[model samples]
Target: MQWIAALPMYNIAPALADDWRALLGAVLGRISPWLDARGDTVRIVDPGADLTAFWLRDDVLLSQTCGYPLLHALSGRVQLVATPAFDAPGCERGGYRSVLVAGAQAGASSLEACRGLRAVYNDEDSNSGMNLFRHAVAPLTSGGRFFSSATKSGGHLASLRAIAVERSADVAAIDCVTLAFVRAHRPELAAGIREIGVTASAPALPFIASKRVPKGLVDALAAALSDVIAQDEALAGRLRLRGVLRFTEADYACIDRYEREAIELGYPRLA
Candidate 1:
């Protein structure tokens, strides 16, 4: 059977894109030997691919999905493989936080100071990009909104650019890991953006398999990732693999709680 794989969420810093692909390819390559059926290559889905649709496709063998989407948009549609642990700031074990950022010229020292600024986000379904950031801003929102205007930047890196380069927005919430990667590898992109605050932590983006895949294959794939972490220190270092943790549906339910809390707190939506 034909299958596809993607890690769109963490594919920041174009310079390191090939390295990331190779690392994923190696992990998947290691797992292929145990499966009766496997693809010789991992199809790195491009930016244009509709990722929500891609996640629901039956042929998706491995892909990383945000916790918010997994709980709100993709519940029961995919099976968790494992959660990647990154050795980056704002990341703890298999959980990560969102970094609230503003343009250097905006002059907002903290989240509270940016009361009526324009806000940008990658997507509404994104945990780090939207959900967590919304929750962070909820308490500060007096009315239905806090931002004077909100725009969708299409992706985290783009959201960063919208604030720092395009100057179209004053603030945005970026995935901490993505921000960390860009700072390390593509410092130019992060030049004018300043991280002023952080959102609450939640389960990291999860590696998932289509439900159509057999349980045995899924188990083997999880084991393969573990083996890669244990045996290939160099590859794991490149991927920033700390350890893969098996997260349950309950663990993901915490994401939904964040949404509910935001609603109950009177800021149901990010302003």
Candidate 2:
């Protein structure tokens, strides 16, 4: 049997291959021989791609959610295997909050003070850098006149750089995960920046498998992950995956609630 897994590339750690191998080994166990006695071929798909193609592929077994929109799109179509939100025995809930970061010299002290100031988002499809920011500021505007201007920075790291270097935007909303990654690996770039505010806590990324997969295999994989979290100290620290939690279902309706609230308040374009 063959299986495919896709992960996001944004600030991905350099130890990704080793991490995957440990994770797959723990999850697949003796079944690994059946997969490939010599080696199992794993293919990674870009998280930014329109994942509808991967979701429709019969050969793919799993994919990770990069943001809420992608998760919403896949809800009814696939089986949600595990999520950080479930707080599986070894997994912890709540990672980081999106922050409104401004240049240290800009002198803006609060969200209200930044009005009429330019803002940057990672991407239109982004949940933390886009949707949450839009929803947060929507109620403050009457006719979509919140920010002076807005643009997509393509990725969270770019959004951070845009504010730090070009000073093009007075502020930018960036995910906490990206911020932590930058601080850990590129402290120089992360310096001279301050967080003005943080968005409400939301669920973290989820690990998912297709519903078409056999239930027996799914159960075994889940058990394996739980075992690794409980017994394998090296694997746990490397993957940062605490444990396997029970899976739950959520849909576009949850996302629609936020969009609807923003639209009703007259801030439809993220201002």
Candidate 3:
């Protein structure tokens, strides 16, 4: 069995390694031994080596992901295994939102008020920071007049910092998950920022696996995750993962509406 775990190539903290090991050991188990016990050989691939192409590949066994672009990229090749949607179950039902934050001095009360101001986003492919930001502001702006400029800060924390410390951008939209994680682990980072508005909610991040994987194995993995969350307090504290919610089968088609609407509004730059 060939299993690969994909993670973003950003400035994630070193402590994430311990979290990964714990998750793999607890949720995925020793893949080789687990598979060998059932007559298979397992190989773990850290495809962060080539994120863009790696995510687009069809043969990889599993990848961790969230929201539209990734789903749009890997729709037919994978299935949802588990996700953090429980925090906002309505998102899975198609009504999730993202919070928009601005610098302490911006005094922007509404999306329209921030027009012509600088902005920062987590990533081009990020749904909360990009797609939803597009969806929220595209309809309300004229061509290239919405913001004076925009920067890709790579991660939510970077975006927040850009707005709060560097004063490079007046506003940013951070995914609620990343925001919550930062608050729990690094509240100082959020010190001078305040939320002005929240975009319509969308689905949370998901753990995905190849469609070829057995249903029983997937269920086992989900059960193991629940066990890990229950048994390992330190891992839970480190990861800040509330709990594993069962996977719901959703496809890129669901988010295509947002993409199309955004495009129609003339914000065609997908990042």
Largest lDDT belongs to which candidate? 1
Give the winner by lDDT: 1 or 2. 1
The residue pairs in collision within model 2 are 90-242, 91-243
TM, every model = 0.93, 0.79, 0.80
Return the TM-score for candidate 3, rounded to 2 decimals: 0.80
Range of the 10 consecutive residues with the lowest summed lDDT in candidate 1: 35-44
Candidate 1 off by > 4 Å: 37-48
Q: Provide the RMSD of all predictions against the true structure, rounded to 1 decimal.
A: 2.1, 4.1, 3.6
lDDT of 2 by residue, 1-271 (tens): 4567664533344665456555655555634543565354444444345665676455555555644654556656666555543222212352335777887767888877778888889777677788778877787786787888898988777777778877777787776666655666666657867778876545555556677666665565556567767788675654555665654554323445666788888888777
Q: lDDT tens string, model 3, 175-270?
A: 765666566656776887887888876656666666767777667656666777768878776665557776464543445677788788787752
Per-residue lDDT of model 1, residues 15-67, tens digit only: 56776676667777777665435434345555345888888888888878888
Which is the better candidate, 1 or 3, if ranked by TM-score? 1
Distance from true position, residue 219, model 1, in Å? 1.1
Alpha carbon lDDT of residue 265, candidate 3? 78
Ranked by lDDT, top first = 1, 3, 2
